[model samples]
Target chain A: MKKTMTRFIPFFIMASFLVTGCNQNIKSTTTAAKPSVSTEAKKDQGPVYKGKVVGKSNKAKQISIEVGKDKDAKTVMVSFDDKTKGLEYAAAGEGAIIAYEMRDGVPFATVIKPKLATLPPGVTVITPTEVKTLIDSNKDFLLVDSRPGNRYSASHLPGAVSIPVCEMQELLQNLPKEKDKLLIFYCGGPT
Target chain B: MSTKSAGQAVKAGYKNIRVMLAGEPAWVKAGYPTYANYGWVCRGNIVLIDLRSAEKDAAARIPRSVSMPFADFADNYDEIPIKAPVVLYSDKDEETTAAMKILHDNGYKKVSLVEGNFLGWKRVGGSLEKGPVVTDVRWKRILAEGEVSVAEFERALADPKVATILDVRTKAEVASGKFPSSQHIPLDELCKDMDQFVCKIRDLQKDEKIYIHCTTGARAEMAYKELKKRDFNAFYLVAEVDCKGNDCSIEE
Candidate 1:
């Protein structure tokens, strides 16, 4: 029964999301269980993100990817579990594309593939270098650090303040009313 | 409105914006005001623009109102006067919010939606003037406002010390061709990259007039505004400019 519940946990959470609409405080919890039994396991992997694998930690279940090419790159983090694949030969400084899903505001990899990822569209993905340039110039723009509260307060990019994407909906009033304000959102890469 | 609307506005590059507390329906119920007749439209104080299909505009429109379809208005919104009150309307009052927001975002000082829109105008006994629409109403304003004249540019070319020609298009776009002795700083990277932009600022020669231009005039015009906002002596190039290889010409 525990194993059955473990297998259905992500599905149940997703169903709850559909019913409740944008739930905050989603627990980033997962249980180890038997892997998928189906032949379409490859297709079950999630959305793709491509970049250089800057770091890896099997113990913490995290991998960092440097999206964008050359010197203008932004690093992102992705969490993995017993199910994540394609990491056996992944080395630091190698290009990779990761398929992922967000649970409890934390992104987790379903499949790790080898390729340069052009992020799926929502917001324009600008590099950290671009952000550094803006900061260095003293040009005014809102740099939002969309990470957990603890992570943000502990350490964040210069000139960035915490406004986690999970709670961004309710925090509209806190945002700038000025029309010219260029808003930039970033979190731990991929994760 | 969703918080994501803020992200969308930022993506769209708006300078002034406002979110209406109550929608049109509520505003209508309060019955503050919609619009008066076309006589109110033609006071020479307010500019009336029709946001409708060309076919719809060709069928009928208020006298002296310009037919600047929403698509065109969105593309060349910088052409619209930021200081003057712009009254806009579309079929059956649709697109009033969108038009108002676009103008609002572009820093238009005064923006009003035709209360009832096109149908409302007719129902309220406003006359519909048929025939070809006048689209050049804003053209005069676009050139006269802050743009550099061809004569001014010609004089500048004669003396580089008098004015600095800055091209804000992409490196790839300029690799093919550009104006003689013009400084190149790609506009997209200006805010974020600023490798070239910084060089100019640090090497600021405040006395020299800066003439900024892009392929057509939009991005150049925008860059000029940014410089002027920072109190730089910058002028926006409004003329059509074509360049091939190392050769370039500004149209008369």
Candidate 2:
């Protein structure tokens, strides 16, 4: 019994060392393993934008990602404010897949976690200037404000219809029947 | 109850609608008085009009009033007397908006509508005259209740030195056009830089009231209240200013 007890002490010390290592998060990619959205959880998030880094305006806290191969590739300009999570470690060209919503024609990244792999979901990002120009021309386009209904009625860009992100799936019914027209969605900036 | 449509009519270039509940027959039976017969034909710089067909105008209308048919109003809107208070009536009280539009477009700032048409005028023991119908109802109410009336505004415009009309629409909206002599200021940018507004409105002229207006009156009202807070003698035109090409006017 004494020999058995003596041997168990060494095993106990080894197990504790492993546990301490895990608590410290000692790994190859050592920044931090933040809470990631699983496949089912991500279903409720806003649209995902996967693309290659085309431009980065660090001062403006903006990034332009190109999401198609060659000529088909479309560039999307994404903006982030102080409240944006996962932005600190998000470097350009790290194969980004951004989950975002637009507000007043500006693309705000709500969840910006890039996959470590190649091509993902790359959508066109409409700029506020472009939207304004379109509005001035009185062109046909769906300007969707993806915020809560109360927030929308309180104050939103003129002509923007309310459609919150949580119920984005239901938007399929409200979308214009004419597929040819432009459909754009926007949300609160980096809240 | 139906004022919403009146406001919308103003937006659509048909301004100043006054609704009458019953016709001239009802008024006469009730022994109500009228403008023509009761020595109430008001004398002032005012354009009284009958918004009826030419045939109807020929049959009966108020004395000293013009016949500008309601349906044809938009086409001949430019001919209204700019400096006069436009008064209007037709077979029904529903046509007041049409008369108001023509008056507004022709730069006649003041507008009033006849609650009783020609029939109502005659029924109210008014003269069964062959002309249009009008009323001093708006003026009386305006003075007493502090309501904004276009007729009052027209009279005010006669003395341009009295008020500085400020156009507070955005550049995009202003690009459509604005009050000819009004100072332009985009309302959204009001607080962004007020020094210029402060500078422009600083000096005093005799009764130099500031009147602000937008395409619609919402922003202008906001700006007016803000300006009023700063102690600048100011008011807002709670009227819809409509424009088609070069033809434009404030529908009240």
Candidate 3:
């Protein structure tokens, strides 16, 4: 009886080895057949820009993307094909990033994503030089002073007029009629 | 009012409504022209609340504006008149919104948030005043309450009745580590997701008390106030809780 049991044990061990080897081969073959699943997962995890479509010039299907909080970021105009879907458009606001691809000189916006935009670190405030250039270049712009009338009386920009943001709508008539004119506005800090 | 984010100057039957990014601060920093005060030239009684640092006040400020620092805002409240048209001015909209909330809560009838905050004021070459004005007295009433200590909060967490723990910190902050069993609802997006949070709270049972915490006590306090205003029983954890074998630092 002992001899018979020993022979059966060896047979059982060989059968188990064959089954395990067969399972391993099957698993390796299945893995080798499909490789795109892992690659597709990696592709989905790509960089995404969150911005808004600030401006759309008629002549050029160019849309401006302003990134970051406070709209402190400069406007970046990217041209999109006229065939682009209007459904792809997004509203302009804080934390909006319009993602587009630049091919040659034209840009094609593929997606518009909104994020909790943040100001870029180390960006200096708008300088006097910039203001001068804006005023000189944009003659038809409206210049609004957000300060109170008393403060406006003390001093103000040459062509600027006081229209406190609180009462801006009421004083709309005081604003320039031309759309192309650059509007320059200012306010006083803590004092 | 149209539903639009701040600084969105869209042309809604108007030509070239440009919203300045930094408003007045950018204008002042640019060394542009400014006036003295809301002049006698304008009609209607307008009250200005100035939110600037003590140092900035020495340079220039809006005349007739009551000085109110953004940090120590709650310290001055009584200065705000309840019946006047209140206009809040700050370097940024963050402070303006804070001030507007305070004023609105105190029974101020007409409150308008300056579009660009204070920076918008200067962009149009407005006005300025140079002097230290008396701060508002209403801030004292805005003192935060219901802050639980860290140890006390941990003890409270042990109670199974505390069904939901909310972390109001930004996503970036939560990526580091968060208290066990706490879900994230950033402060900025809290209003947007308030319905989802309420639904979750209801699923857990309306009687279940919700605990909230942020990097620091400030955001948690804000969350607690906002939730309570919406009739939710919310508590703010004032101190940091232990997470991942390390103490969570409360951002100030």
Candidate 4:
């Protein structure tokens, strides 16, 4: 019965997350578990925890990665220190791969790797200077500023039109009628 | 934002679309003119300078303006902080144009001009003050939160072991030039193969410090988030970088 309850611990934690939202403290009940899992089990040892981070604390040097999927998911609170690798990149709401070891029944993160967002395919990135060059050379392209209206009014690139991303559908008429014309858009640089 | 906007444009039947990821901040940082609306000139946080003669300034000047005569502008331009968002106005078009060039040449990142100058301000019934002005140009640059100081970045550049400089630019951009000691990892590749990247750099532990940079720091910032998410000590430089071979010049 103790082992069966241990298996269901994750489901309870995930249900709590759904109710409490993202901003809440989550604890792992695995604190009392003995250190029977070997650290060298990098392969099918099933020791590596791959999941999305649910919460973290910079001061406490700890992160909670949600392992398993949906109904079976549970938040695993992992503590780290100066010895922990890749601790700088751990953030909540992002996917991460963590390797850990249970010491004194506590899961201590030894390595934390992040899963980053990939840009959508079929898009090419340009620079400010390159856009300027196109403007100076009088290229046959429409330069669009995708920032909010207030920022555009404060200041914007030369010959660029104001087309806020939120209002793109409403301001579709502002774009050139030609479908094949070059359309270059920019906003306040990538955050 | 541009990427999302481009996606919308694509859906709207705009076939050829490209994204300038660096956007307006990068354009202003590259020493280009950004035209300020009349409302911005009246209420925005900016160093509004009357570039006309002292006689013109004392007779009728915009509020929150200092008299910096075009004739002696070269001498007084240095008084304005390089990072100050400067907006200039003068009766003569020639003077305003000349004053903008002077500031841009001197590394003033955010330089702009009031639409239509002083006459335009008055034409729109904008507020003005007369007689001897008391407000002198006063500005000091404060680095944005989390931005790496140029001096500290340079110090790290001089010593490779202290921090690994990660260039997050594309292959074409890197082909032109890069820092001698930077680890080459385009931001797109870093996003897809972060696990492989961590394994590849096994010599440097997860706590190893990495400084990320791109042509205009946009991609560097994006890459910074990725590295930080994985628990790597990372900092991104928010400056315009121009490189020719091994030689590179950074402007903030």
Better of 1 and 2 by lDDT: 1
Mind giving the per-residue lDDT tens digits that candidate 1 earns over B1-252? 112343434445544322111212222222222333344564535677888877788789976778888877788556665656577788845466677667665666445656467887889887788887777655233354668887888777778766888887767668789887788776544533434464764355766688887766656655665566456788877666778887887863
Where model 1 places Cα greater than 4 Å from the true spot, the runs are: A1-191, B1-40, B43-155, B158-162, B170-172, B185-204, B217-230, B238-240, B249-252
**Which number leads on lDDT?**
4
Candidate with top TM-score is 4
Q: Residue A115 error for model 4, in Å?
A: 9.9
In candidate 1, residue A47 scores what lDDT? 69
Evaluate model 3: give its TM-score. Answer: 0.30
Docking class of 1: incorrect
Which portions of model 2 miss their true places by more than 4 Å? Answer: A1-191, B1-148, B201-207, B244-246
Residue-by-residue lDDT tens digits, candidate 4, A80-179:
7789887654665545668888877667788765432112334444556677899899999988877787777777777778888778665588888999
Write candidate 3's Cα lDDT for A1-191 as tens digits.
34543443343332221111000111112332221222321342333344444434332334555444554644444555655443233433223334457566445666543322111121112333455577778656655656555555544444566665456455555655564444444444211
The alpha-carbon deviation from the true structure for residue B190 of candidate 4, after best TM-score superposition, in angstroms, is: 32
What proportion of the true contacts does each candidate reproduce?
0.04, 0.00, 0.16, 0.62
> B118-190 in candidate 4: lDDT tens per residue?
8878898988889996448865455554456777788889998778888877777789999988888766567
lDDT of each: 0.56, 0.49, 0.49, 0.69
What is the C-alpha lDDT profile of model 1 across A28-147, one tens digit per residue?
A: 122122222212334655566665665564534566666665576555667788887777424454446678898766677877654322111222323344455776799888766554
TM-score for chain A of every candidate model? 0.41, 0.38, 0.30, 0.43
The DockQ of predicted model 3 stands at: 0.07
What's the residue-level lDDT of A111 in candidate 1? 77
